[model samples]
Target: MSRFRYSFQKIVDLKTNEKTQAEWILSSAVNDLRVEEDQLSDLKHHKSEVQETLVSAAANRTTVSELMLYQKYLDHIDHQILNKNAAVRAAQINVEDKQSNLTAKMREEKVWSKAREKAKLHFTAALLKKDQEALDEMSVSRHKQPS
Candidate 1:
């Protein structure tokens, strides 16, 4: 009997590779989003600490210039936090896109895999049938011969 060969093995491999690449892209985007979120958290923590210091200084009769400087610094940190939030949002979107692409590639690969499995089953059935026929012929020949 002839060996079973999958006709679309190459296509399956290609789709698997594409899925791997998309997974990598998604991982990178997720990592980037995490980093941006961490930075934003740190900035917010620092702003709170500065605010507390400013309140203590005001109670201790701090100069107007110093108070103004602290307020300006707080505003700057707020702006940075806003920008970081936007960056995190953009990274999230990128990860979602990559995830979608990976899903598509995986689905394509599964289709080819199913086709290969069907072909193998058909080949096996044919081989079994051929073997059964050969056995039947040999048995009939033996019975026809002299006992």
Candidate 2:
């Protein structure tokens, strides 16, 4: 029997490749989001520490000049935390977009794969029908032979 050849094998391969590439993209985006979140956490932790220091300074006989400096440093850290929070939000949005793209690619690949399977099934049936016809022809030929 002849080998079954898919006419759109290239398309199927391309679709599979696209899906793999999308997975990689989504993975990278997720990693970026994680980094952003870790940075945000670090900033929040630093802000808390600064607040503690400022409070401690207020309880001690700290110089007024030094107290002002602590307040300024606290303000700086608070600003940084705000900026980091924005960065984290942007990274989250990017991850969501990548996730959607990956989903779309997966769907396209599944469609092509299903089409290929159906084509293979049809090819198999045709091959079986042709073989049966050949066998029937041989049987008719044998029955017509002179006894």
Candidate 3:
């Protein structure tokens, strides 16, 4: 019923809203990391299949010129696959790092959020007290009048 109590209630409500927002953001980051990891795994599998194809090509060679040309093409393809796979792995790692950073930020936000709520409640209480003191002084001056 007191002004301080009402102010503290409002502070609690605001903090709850902020916590819900933080949770939603963190959950989205986790989902993105999971999807990136899946893509990285698929890239690794593709690289293995490409290596197998090149090995088979080498074994089926007939003439020197034909074998050399076939090998050159396979080598080029293998190089490309290797580069692409590396990039996928790097991207996956970056996604994981982003997820971790988001988690840490969420925790820090929770801590700071509680402090923010407390400060808001305290400020409201101080304002209420100042207003009450002003009203009391006015009442005393009115009562001491020579009416």
Model 1: per-residue Cα lDDT at residue 104: 89
Estimated TM-score for each candidate: 0.91, 0.93, 0.47
| Alpha-carbon RMSD of each model | 1.5, 1.3, 8.3
| Model 1, C-alpha of 114: deviation from truth (Å) | 1.1
Task: Tell me which residue pairs clash in candidate 2.
Answer: none
Q: Please list all clashing residue pairs in model 1, or write none if there are none.
A: none
Residues 114-134, model 3: lDDT tens digits:
776687788788888988999
State the weakest 10-residue window (summed lDDT) of model 2. 42-51
- Give the local distance difference test score of model 3: 0.67
Ranking by TM-score: 2, 1, 3
lDDT measured at residue 30 in model 1 versus the true structure, 0 to 100: 85
Best by lDDT: 2
Cα lDDT tens digits for candidate 1, 7-108: 878887887788788888888888988888898899889989999998998899889999999999989988998998898888888888888988888888
Candidate 3 clashes: the total is 0
